[model samples]
Target chain A: MTYPKSINNLISNLKNLPGVGEKTAERMALAMIDFDKEKLGSFSDSITDVKDKIRHCLICNNLSEEDECIICKDKTRDSGILCIVDDVRSLMLFEKNNLFNGKYHILKGLISPSNGIDPEDIDIEALINRVEKEKIKELIIAVKPSLEGEATALYIAKRLEPKNITVSKIAHGVPMGADMEYLDAITLRTALFERKKIS
Target chain B: MTYPKSINNLISNLKNLPGVGEKTAERMALAMIDFDKEKLGSFSDSITDVKDKIRHCLICNNLSEEDECIICKDKTRDSGILCIVDDVRSLMLFEKNNLFNGKYHILKGLISPSNGIDPEDIDIEALINRVEKEKIKELIIAVKPSLEGEATALYIAKRLEPKNITVSKIAHGVPMGADMEYLDAITLRTALFERKKIS
Candidate 1:
């Protein structure tokens, strides 16, 4: 009840984040208190910098330092193939594993109608526009295989079919409701290679 | 492998802490990346602030902004009854429950000979001097019941016995080798209240 006001404020702010409880916040606070001043300052600065400098790529909606992310900027990658993902984190995972040599289109979220997030609310239109403009040869639907994921994939596939692009979803070997990052590199590569087109 | 230098540095630093492994570090790193810029800045600032501004209280070895901690500065607290702890984190647990009304003496570390941490390496001399100079009536050992903890308690007990002040160890109702933070509040309180004198 009588904690230092600044410390209490710090703890309160920390509590707002997911998975961080009071004890965890306190432990983090104590760790912060123990960190060197310059490192702590940089740590604080990094938080704001990521928010201010990082944004959805104008071209693909993936996290980007400029109008487009590094993958979009890299000339070596296949500009004709676009991997559509549910979030920037997936894009990062792909980039980390070097599994995808193509460009990415981050949806930023899924089409969860139950959560009031419809297809129109996400970056589906931008993705469609990108496919049309770029004359993309392949559109890989890397979205999760939940009910919403399936619905979104089908919706995107329907929209892209007329455009003559070869649309496919990653294989179902990844267990349902599992995170893509948890899949080992070999498994992920296999999933990507064994992808099937929607009839 | 090709993460932004700053992001990589942060992940590396986070991974260096105890209990945080590769997956946890990745999760923490992603959380930092996703955190609101302003809040992350504050969290970073607090880390440095804690490292730069916080130091061991001169009287009791507890961390404080000044030479003495709030507990040590309070005229109402029973400084004459020093509560000896192995680390500042343990002292905070007592403070969180408002269990102890006395001032604390943090050893800053435990006595682990294999780890090269001995009684002399900590503030044991300062504690002995405080007992000798002050009208200290009781010295409560709140260290764990591990082999190291028992050794530290016995070592400190021998040192203080000549001064005639009572030396007591927290009760063993707490199962052996249990961390103070994990103990339930009532059990911890009971342990404190039912402490037995060592000398």
Candidate 2:
């Protein structure tokens, strides 16, 4: 009886979002109330709308409100140059840099054997079909540098090799401006071994 | 063309939530891809559902899915005792403690002239009406001891002084089990000021 039922309900609903624990949700609910009744109502509506209306594009499995996302439908994108990533977030990070004109294929997940996530469970089959049908000239693997990411990249690389398509990986090395002395032995070795000749 | 349109839209929607900034929203969007797609969809839906289904209770401006929230509808709560809180989050915190058995009235905000918030902006009138109609015996102010909170409490006390209602503020002093040596000057002063005679 102390809390109006709606306030409690809103707080509980907020818990559904990532990083919103109970205490944080409560704080958020209070903040919403402070914004005025109308805004509080909007906050509630927005939460539900995002959940209901937003979905992954069926083709690329990227967040979308339609069947094919904007990137997939855009004519300006070079469909032949595909960048494969472990999640939709990585694609966004790349887009923020505005350096790539290629299309993206979200893997949805990596081959995490410890967690029982296998490559077969993700959209690998769709990726293969996309490569074949879309006449993709290059498949650039840009997954994280974790063990699972490396394994997934390798799996995808092997799959694409049979079609005679160019399979490349974004190089993993010390970040820009990082000192060479601080670099780990394995990374330093990889960077040295894969060094490209500067023309 | 850079970020899939759907992903961008979804991230933008996420940014509207309480405590969600651009960076946090981006991280959450990416994390969503790692979770079950269906669950992510449902999480978004829940937000909209809560917004549409819930509203403020007419009597107390507390959150409610119905015209009157669960607390307002309940027959068991002591209507005579009303606990006044500056924000709805305080109500949630008290609910976690499970100590109070009375009803609650959320002010929605505290009186803060600096931030352009005053008593008129909140549900102060509704609070007075509830007190009058219910013939409440004790009104316990459970707001924080912040400058705004203190100012709000003083304002509410003055307004209710004419009503002959017994108004009391919650205690503010050293937290239980906290060492006195570790306590700052403000807390020490509050502890000394709020000292109760023990038998």
Candidate 3:
């Protein structure tokens, strides 16, 4: 049956989200109809608020509400270390694990010639400026192990080579405690090639 | 890292949607931050419009903007045949297939004693009133085959028994073109028990 114009609009808008298809959008629209007016208003307001308030950090280009992101502003985080990631989501992942007590730089995207995205299209220039001006001694590249990710990492490493900065990429291998048999060919090859001399 | 207050709120609200977990919600929130200001505004407006405009049909309890839903308001559909579904999403599924040209009655929910949902909790009374007041000759029970779905269909069938209405439930068996070996035992049993005479 044809839904109301507003309902259809909501469903279409919801379809724009990642992983949401037509059926899932329709289900979400129907579920929203059951929400109370106050809850619906708050939910809608939250969407608008996110768009209005969230902005890129001046230093790292990471998502923030102020001029500088929390990571950049914090005194405890090591200013001598910087982690570069393809997007804010990856930066958040590292933060969630509490594995890196350093500042971050969000590239926003990788260099992909197929998609017409180049080094200039992302925040690469800002990253260079940050590394040149800041007291960062080591730069960690934490991008996905895709072709575009490799290209972006290599480009950044070459650019920072003249500045005498120690640049490194996160290791690629089978995940911790995962079955080696299920690992993909590339991951297995990388794991074997990068095998450490454990004493 | 702790997200901004607004971003965190948006992520929490997104998690309320079906199949969306913490990671999915975070990804959605991050993606939304990349949307242009105009697209973001339109998305937020659509949500508010859906909340303000969508309502239940006064006659069949289906979702609508006006007093009657599209199915109930359509003059070309057969008024004598009515399909009763547990929710609007199920009704939309039938409509999407373009197989049913009859009116629809949305029960909104199924009765589950364990969940403390009773007959009065849904739109059962409205279904009875519609059947009595309208020119309904046949009532198609299209609820799911779960315990709650069966109980709801049976209860509705018994309630309409005294009205001389031809109450029929949708067939329960193996899906079309599914292999017998892959089919579950309950489905195979139901398919065998409900086997039709070829004549």
**Number of the predicted model whose DockQ against the real structure is largest:** 3
Error of 2 at B58 (Å): 4.6
Query: Chain A alone, model 3, TM-score?
Result: 0.92
lDDT (Cα, 0-100) at A19 in candidate 2: 82
Find the 10 residues in a row with the least total lDDT in model 1 chain A: A1-10
- Lowest-sum lDDT 10-residue window in model 3 chain B: B84-93
Docking class of 3: medium
What's the true lDDT of residue B163 in model 1? Answer: 77
**Stronger candidate by lDDT (2 vs 3):** 3
Model 2 regions more than 4 Å off: A2-12, A29-80, A111-136, A156-165, A179-199, B2-7, B29-59, B65-75, B112-133, B155-165, B179-184, B196-199
Tens digits of per-residue lDDT for model 3, B79-197? 99999888777888898889799998878689999999999998588788888889699999998789999999989989988888899999999999888789988899999999999
Interface RMSD of each: 3.2, 4.5, 1.2
TM-score of 1: 0.81
lDDT of 2 by residue, A1-199 (tens): 3445455565665676678898888776656544654554454444345555567777777777678888888899888899988776688788888878888898868888899998788768899998899899998899988888888989999888889899988988777999888899889877889888999
lDDT by residue (tens digit), candidate 3, A1-199: 6778999898988998999999899888878888888878888999999888888888888888999988989998899999988777788778888999988888868999999998889868988888878867999999989999999999999998888789999998889999877889989988899999989
Worst 10 residues of 2 chain B by lDDT: B41-50
What's the TM for chain B in candidate 2?
Answer: 0.88
- How far out, in Å, is residue A10 in model 2? 4.4
